[model samples]
Target: MAQQLAQGGLTGAAKLKAVTDLINSLTQDLSTSSLGPRERDAALDELKVYARDPRNADPIFVKEGIETLSKHAFDGSSATTSRNALRCLANCLLVKPSTRNIFVDLGYPEKASIKLTTAGVEDEFLISRIIFLTTYGTSVNLQNLIDQHHLADAILQNLTRHVKLWTGSSGSSFKAASQDPMTDMALTETAKLLFNVTHFCRQKVDSFTPAIALIVTLICQHALPQPKPLDPPLGSLVNALLTLNLASEQGAAALFPKANPAALCERLIQVLDKAVRSYPDRELDTAVLPLITALRKIYELAPAEGVQRVMQAKLLPTTKDRKKVLGKGQSLASLILRHTTNAMAPEFSKAVSHMLFELSDKDATKFVQNVGYGFASGFLFQNNVPVPESVQESFQASEGGRQRAVNAITGQFIDKETAPELPEMTDEEKEREAERLFVLFERLKSTGVMNVENPVARAAREGHLGRDVIDGKDRVEELD
Candidate 1:
């Protein structure tokens, strides 16, 4: 019958309609088919030929044929039939637009996706076809699949499994032209597609609550690769993290409350541990901020201050000699002591203190001189934290005055070598450094520090630190 239609004996439209009617009949009685494996194979061969016919390329025939194929793919009794159905779908999709009247008439959306979703088809062949179409097929089909059906989630799940499989079996000399890279790139493209589609979908809703919820979960799971510096960049992970953080901070209250900060912290730690265990030394230089951010988010969620403190004990670095295989060194303890301390978030005090105590005597002193006062200032100013009156008073009454006095105290203890290096003083270097520091000071000024004079302004007032007087105080203040 299909061959007769292909021969063009009857009017093309009429014959195409007839084929569509037969397909619709097949869709209806598909579950009742008791064809044996051999019979199923013969039936699929016929469908495949019909799908390739030029006359059956009309939109109505294509739609009914794809629907029929999807139904047969889902029928579970015949593997050969399902494979043939997918082959037909792929061949038809690969046809030129002029010849694919069915696709053009149907708006070239992911009709297969809609059919699968509406029909609730979970057959592996249909899934594989969906995956191929989304990864390598056109944007029209992908958008339709994502928008008309909840296909993003399905793609994500499939991509995740694919990643595990490909990465697990991969060997050295990895190239996309090779089996591993090709497979991995295909999976990666799937992930990228899902991300782009989800982003577009997010704009339609007031808040991307549902889309973000899935994105966050996926980000927290895979973006942070295990064993630091493993294969991907940490910056890549930040795209997802920062997006989640910004969304939670902005109007996504449901997202924030629903967001599991603690789980996020744990997952980050797993990646960090892998990185630390893999490349310990260099990580302290670059990994500190991200780790701190993760911890801070977790600390934010702790109900009791004491709980935050305890959580710190669990998450904070304890070892001093952690180094990567390359002999590059990262001191988590040093980082914690240097970056998180008094005057800083109190959740970090205990951890910072313990680590500070472990640094080299000279290095410890230098660390204090550079960031110590900043840390002290944080502790001193925070009403939520307690500082001894003796220390506070000592900080307040010194020669340079309270702020300068604290700086002096920290400066006295710091090792010159370990003290954070000020930028080079060459004219060119100084200018760039000045701009950078101005940005930094502006940030500091905006933190609502009372009695806080801008560092550049204070330097100008003292006639010290640099020869040129700091200009644009108001502009700096405006930025602040």
Candidate 2:
């Protein structure tokens, strides 16, 4: 019957008549109590095809057409028939969101959410999407899905099932992808729906805690290369996690267990490294923030061993690169730091800066010492954080008293023999340089960057600035 529209070149009134006749006929057959098994499946399939085309879809919604589709979708006829019915409903909802209310008033969302609890991969994909669509213009209450129908439980269960199916007992690539492509599509649709549910009902995120650890393990176990910034499961997993409180007591337990405290974080660091390498600068501006934020949150609550592992991750500056300038190579830490200074991606840069700062425990001293004053000062100066005098005279060792062979300010190891040498300044040049320094300090003080004393002005006040006036009648505060 659908071939009549295409093969016969039915046009104008002829096409409309043919489509109307097909839909009405299918609707009648599908609604029939005595319809045979094969006839019901064929009718459902034809209705699905009819609903797919916008022009021919009006009759599907004409008179109780959606009602008929909704009945068969979960009417306990047969799995194939139910899935076919679901496709028809999926198409109608996609093409005309206005009919969402029509479907909702029929009370299928509640039924759909329940179906999700036991649905297979295909049904899971279809039902989750159908319920997710009701969230748009319809008056569907997402919290009701959480509080009333236990939708979060279903999402987590499906994610666990996907994990087992994709990776099996061994740590490897998603084997299900080669045998079947629906596995990938199933995850994408399911994740989108999960993001919606959690976004609308944030207070209920505890319901999703178990899935977080599973996602982390899945990401870690995938041995294949992370070839893109937002591949399936990676991007989807991050999206589900973005709203979750990975820092909560429950969340913390799942991530940093006692057996191997830093295992998950170290694994996530590897994932972040791949993302840094895969993402273009424009993509980096938005695609990678959640991953960065997730790592930061976990690190903030990580144990000592975990912290050490995270600091030693490729995302942070290392002494091995202290021979050259920081943020200057294709290494993971360098690429991440390169983004920290990117002007096009200010928020991305800020997140990168925050991640680095957290790795240093947010200490002003460690911040400057680890990344050098040049990098740390930019972050500090941009956010109006006043630098203490101690951060200026950077320490050469970490808190554990491990000394490093790196310049405090430049973050580079100086080979004095090969270092570029310039001539010493003459007396006049020295005086001119002092004057310039005075002017620069004065400007900095004026701008409120720091409430610092102008040493040159203080020198002049105490008569120590080229005036032989160190002797004062009223005692001036001595310069240190």
Candidate 3:
């Protein structure tokens, strides 16, 4: 039968029909009481061979194959057979997008999702393939997965479980083992599937915040480090970052709030910096653009405190010497400016400029001083690609625009206007307060309350030490 299916001179329709008949027969055999597990396994193997053919993507055949495979998939009789069935379905879905609906219609989504929970490496791979394929269709298709099969939740659960398993009790173990090529590849595909789901179903992604956080944490934990000679892989890390960027763009900023923005900014800068250092001459525009975009999104969506934290982090080169060499001692601002000036791709430069513009909006004088006015004017110059008008205006308006330019040209750290000083306690006042505290401590000590040992006594001491200990006791008595 296999020979006949592989034989030449058969029409596509004829081949599909033959494969369909083979699948039907296999399903019948598996259903029979007389067949042993070995026989059933053999039939499933045969089904896998034919079902994987691109010609077998006809909707009717796909539906029939899915129904048969889904039965065995959920039966738990044999992992190998179930996995083969999943592989066949995945292959068909991959070849034909139309089969995705058929897959959902035949209740395969729910079954596939259930399998995802307990799937081993190979089975998980196949199941992920199916989910990834489904993601290629329209948003409506994604909605079906979310609404009917709860695919979003399932994938999140699967990712969380696998990541936990991979990371073990201490996440460092997973990072250490991430260098295994096969494990890395599997995880990469998983991350890709996650990216697709999140990208297609933005409105629904919020509910999966825990899963999103886990993925971000995993990426930040494992990928932020400089790539080892034998790191797990970069694909998952890249995809995870892309997913985060997409989610943030779609108004999901909650996940990033707790992530140390300063550390995150430093990590992103490190990725771009390392890439540029490695390939000094080549155009890494495509490779580094996503990182830059992700950085931009972080700045746009992060809370004020988070954004301030990132701004305070040392992200750019501080010294002119380092800028000349394109060497170490670089700050985030310097990196952005240098890349803006020298980027081979206009889009890359634009991304960096937009980030700079945003930072300028946050503090125009600081941006002007940090990158220097000459570099700032050139970056904000409206030649071919223009900076936001507001950015240009902000620079012009900063320090009435004149002093900032002069200060930038002269390399002066002087600010024309100083921030208002906060009120401070003088030494005399400090000494007086200290003396009062000492007297209060002595009084409390004499009363056998040198420390805050009891809640009532602590409350009384804290409340009354400023007054008299007797008054504190009276207040405590009134409360009692």
Highest-TM-score candidate? 2
Give one digit per residue, the lDDT tens place, for model 1 in 392-439: 221221232322233233333112214445654576665665667767
TM-score of 3: 0.62
What's model 2's TM-score? 0.76
TM-score, per-candidate, Cα-based: 0.35, 0.76, 0.62
RMSD vs true structure, all candidates: 16.0, 8.7, 24.3
Which 10 consecutive positions of candidate 1 have the poorest summed lDDT? 319-328
109-157, model 3: which lDDT tens digit per residue? 6667666766666666788778777666533366666677667676666
lDDT of 2 by residue, 305-336 (tens): 65556555556776666657776667788788
What's the lDDT of the predicted structure labeled candidate 3?
Answer: 0.57
The stretch of ten residues in a row with the least summed lDDT in candidate 2 is 467-476
Sort by TM-score, best first: 2, 3, 1
The predicted structure with the larger TM-score, 1 or 2, is: 2
